[model samples]
Target: MINVNEVVETNEMIEKENLDVRTITLGISLLDCISSDLEQLNKNIYNKIYEAAKDLVATGEQISREFGIPIVNKRISVTPIALIGGAACRTKEDFASIAQTLDKVAKAVGVNFIGGYSALVSKGMTPADKLLIESIPLALSTTDVVCSSINVGSTKTGINMDAVRLMGTIVKETAEATKENDSLGCAKLVVFCNAPDDNPFMAGAFHGVTEADKIINVGVSGPGVVKTALEKVRGESFEILCETIKKTAFKVTRVGQLVAREASERLGVPFGIIDLSLAPTPAIGDSVADILHEIGVEHAGAPGTTAALALLNDQVKKGGVMASSYVGGLSGAFIPVSEDQGMINAVEAGALTLEKLEAMTCVCSVGLDMIAIPGDTRDTTIAGIIADEMAIGMINQKTTAVRLIPVIGKGVGETVEFGGLLGYAPIMPVNQFSCDAFVDRGGRIPAPVHSFKN
Candidate 1:
């Protein structure tokens, strides 16, 4: 199984092709830490995460150094706080206190971010879920590393229009609360339809109630690697092009498999899954859009872009599954606007727009991610957008999420900088058409007829 040529090829991918393990996330369940007493609950949550994740960052660094593979981030995801704090959290402030505790543990352990400040309200909201939902603005504004998500729709359960409407207002409040940071708080809050439990990516990762106590999941990314391989087969037949991508993806996923096994064995935690997603960064040559360009699209949102994405997404899963038995999470291509420079370029070139991006999400890994919209855009408009995306997921039975930032006091044609992994974005315009009457009809959108398959 070992060969010098293979080893050298791997090295080339790492050194020049932007191939790396994106994250090693530790999923720790907080169910056992729940208590009827507020103080005791916070203390228990803090101690549990601290003991479980203290060595995560150091372990990731050790693996990267020894293997000569770059591990970008160490993260932690806990069981949704809404479930863990149900008994003790009486008000929004109580839920926010839990977020503070989570932020404290994340800082102590030195991880980049900690997720699971979330509530699952796909069909209806519990009292605790409502509290957690209402508290997201305060919780995200006050905490540095805590990320939040709300699942407002799912295939099994219909979309909760009430939650969708509430989230629109909450998104606006979150932007206002962090206007000094270019509404960065909204960047950390994702609203999802069919959200996965074991996602290793931030702003959406959370340990589902069904998972083990603690486990290690790894996310791998290699857009440049894929693009480089595709270039070798330029102007080739569709069959040859697809074969090239599958082979390249298999190689990239094997790297993630090795890292996941090593980290799990060393940390004494069970390995969860290998998330072989083509997660791009602000860095050049590391964009999923670039891979699309190599596939024949002039720009990410141009004609045939969705078809190109669907092909890439299918082949990635095909190749990834062959490499690792436990390939899960959002293991495909991510199309975040701010995180991918090519997508930003497409927007500036007028080849991409919010409408085109939404159309693309029907085929990509996630939906409308890291997009900056005008602050004056009505909350009802945001809800309408979320509803449309959620409807896509519910009908198609796939995962779709929205991470939109309504940059306060910013309008279309302006730009806002959200430094680091979240790069700068030009403010995109939204339709001024009124959706108030539509959003005002607050009731659940019943699941599609296909959902009744029993």
Candidate 2:
């Protein structure tokens, strides 16, 4: 029934190339879990995650074994806790308890991480939303599996200057509180301008208000596959390289669509979006940086690399568009510094720097991810990083975010470990120049040139 030549072509195309699926995320909406009583809400949170995610690890494992492709992380993203938990929570203690309960269920079910411990305050913040924001450090530091996010802006609502200001402080506190492990918990958090709700990725993933009440979304990863495809035609035309990536992405996303449909049927939740991101791991063969190398750059920081990435990103979208009708989230490529060994190595080798990373944000899926700065970096500097990245996304009308950790007591070139799947980062320097004027201009940058289109 199948074409033998096509099968062989795909095989020959992928031989010697290391490819693996990144995350098969289960997006569970917590709107139904809200209740007037704190006790009832807690009960609903536990039951929903456990019931929805109980078979997730097993399903992912079975699929990985069936396909001979390694599925790295099994994760879940929920509705922002503040929206669901605020009704019953009157104090930080009540909110902290809810965060603790969510973390417990994630570990119990063996998920790599649980996201959506978040708040969306682009327009304004509610009393309970304010409390949850204040408790982020305590919530994250006390929980192992809980990851948090805050959506401070969007194309429709514009950037919330006040919320952005609060987030800068919260991020700093989160880093300080968890400084023991190189401020690792800060690495698990994200601040976004236009974050999607059905995102099946971590650190920043959360079920959005527009998403289904319950659904299964898959974040398919195959950087190694793409890199492998590039290796086949070392001297091929750039157009040919792009074509190869597009074809490979088509196959990778097809696999993700299959997994999402099957997983949804098994769980009885509606099938959700498939995130086609090149999510790399700490392992040797799973690097996005490697793909850049295969594309002709010795490392990610080489010249012409940004243009190459833009091409790779565009081709991936072209392939993904044909594979699935429903595609969303920050899908394309990820460059998490600590998580990808090649990126970490590049930073340590002086081939990468914070400013260059900022430049890359213009062409990548996420921005300034997993970067570490000196412990003594001023709060204004961190806020400056957030503002710069947010401005890029705001201007381009894309979903870009930052997850930078200011490792307490660590200076440039020093390595800080967050243990397990979080990996580690060598501290990089931030500009010593003051952003006082830029940050103080804080009212709001307003929507950019394109944002004004009629």
Q: Which structure among the candidates has the greatest lDDT?
A: 1
State TM-scores per candidate.
Answer: 0.99, 0.94
TM-score of 1: 0.99
Task: For model 2, name the residue pairs that clash.
Answer: 197-208
The reply for model 1, stretches above 4 Å from the true place, is none
Backbone clash numbers for all candidates listed: 0, 1
Model 2 Cα lDDT, one tens digit per residue, 104-152:
9999999999999898876778898889989999998999889999877
**Tens digit of per-residue lDDT, candidate 1, span 1-454:** 9699999999999999999999999999999998999999999999999999999999999999999999999999999999999999998999999999999999999999999999999989999999999999999999999999999999999899999999999999999999988899999999999999999999899999989999999999999999999999999999998899899999999999999999999999999999999999999999999989999999988898999999999899889999999998999999999999999999998999999999999988889999999998788999999999999999999999999999999999999998988888989989898999999999999999999999
Q: Residue 173: error of model 2 in Å? A: 0.8
For model 2, give the 10-residue run with minimal summed lDDT: 9-18
lDDT (Cα atoms) of all candidates against the true structure: 0.95, 0.82
List where candidate 2 sits over 4 angstroms from the true fold: 1-16, 440-442
Worst 10 residues of 1 by lDDT: 422-431
